[model samples]
Target: MTDKSRKPVRKAVFPVAGLGTRFLPATKAVPKEMLPIVDRPLIQYAVDEAREAGIEQMIFVTGRGKSAIEDHFDISFELEATMRERGKDMSALDGTRLAPGHCAYVRQQEPMGLGHAVWCARDIVGDEPFAVLLPDELMWGKTGCLKQMVDAYQEVGGNFISVLEVPRDEVSSYGVIDPGKADGALTEVVGLVEKPKMEDAPSNKIVSGRYILQPEVMRTLENQGKGAGGEIQLTDAMARMIGTQPFHAVTFEGRRFDCGSKTGFVEATLALALEREDMAAQVRQIAARLLRG
Candidate 1:
């Protein structure tokens, strides 16, 4: 099938080059993306999500102190040998290992902004539509959130962003979209504003961490001016793509946690643990007892 006939999303870019200062001591040596929600690191969730969406090539934009992120995906020969000695199943280790060419890594070098980090992958991404997932934003849904948007891209065929309705008063904290029309969960985006005030927001809907962006966005980000934070914001680059490209916001059916925040991190851990059949009962009872105390 041609590029348009088939899904245009064959690649995915993961912007994980952050310093992760919020987590401090633990993150001093360990990248925050390596921090576990329960059993998997934060970046693993984003990788798993992308793989589920049929993403063939996984590109990670990394920075200093992010070597653990690379080592995590590499084969653990010693660990696998130990597991084999104990008769552990190999099926559980399938997706966790990268086979030579399946994954690629590039450095962001400096902490310019999200836009610049994304721009670092332009050469690798080439000229095809790719998905972007922020590891810090943990999204939980029946189906992986990225998978849901990939399913939508098949029908809509343009830049698709995972959108969610945030409270009006809280809109200023996120990049808000100026919605044009709604067809069930998908909303046509006429314009996008970067963290506008509650009253000035185009709509209550805010752009979440999941995105299926066109390759052209990379070109836009290359020369994009600094926005809001005196850094080249990815939202600013995306906003410039309006009219020239088809932009739509997809309302996800999932629970998204800003795990970069302390509260959100704890909540994600608890929620994910509760979803596990093995840990559900014990974790729930402990939580209940703790609440009583």
Candidate 2:
């Protein structure tokens, strides 16, 4: 059961220390999180979602060559001044800027894994429950996914993980959940299996990138040993918390694009571009032409 007096979740952690080896040369100097989807970078979408979910502090776990990500969120006075001089609308940047003192950064010195990256923010998160968002997963919906999870967390309240059903064949790509009881969109998670093969998988409902975890999960991660891929896996730590707390899975009521992969990135770019009133017609025409050839 949730502690009625526990403080509300006001902070969010973003782990972005990975080297985008798949994108190669393009990501040589530019961090993959800085890649643009239409006009906004991937990281902006996650930050915007966190803000919408009432997250007050944005904590970033970064590494070498990731300075670009930090600068993107910082004030660019020169550019803003030039835009004002040119009589351009600056409203587009309104959501992107973080208020002074509302942001913090921690260094992930090694390329350990997602679990370690999240652990790096242990001090900032302190004793409060916090949200974790992976920028590579772009979720589109009328309401942000984290906000939906937060709403669910308010009711059930231990650890809330955003989940989505994937094909059985693709179960190996994610951490599969063993559901216990169903209650509309929320399911009681009995067990979790990280990247299990099709035959070993428990269910098709896989854990997505959004999480609402109690501070105790940080304690679990403190001595978490390496699991799959020989690295400390967040899934491993989360699995240990299932029975000890009120663990539940909230299915996302939206489309999710895995922007970390090349194909998913292109699909997300096209999907978002086609949604824009200004670019829809032209993008449709171009898509039609490409499909015909």
What 10-residue stretch in candidate 1 is worst by lDDT?
1-10
Per-model lDDT: 0.88, 0.92
Q: Per-residue lDDT tens digits of candidate 1, residues 1-293? A: 24652346888889989888999988999999989999888888898988888888899999987889889889998999999999988887667886787799999998889999899999998878899999889888889989998888888778888988878999999888889989999899999887788889989998899888888898899778887668888888887888877888889898999999999999999999999999999999999999999
TM-score per prediction, in order, is 0.95, 0.97
Give the Å shift of residue 65 in candidate 2.
0.7
Measured on C-alpha atoms, candidate 1 has an lDDT of 0.88
Model 1 ranges with Cα > 4 A deviation? 1-7
Candidate 2 stretches with Cα past 4 Å from truth are 2-6
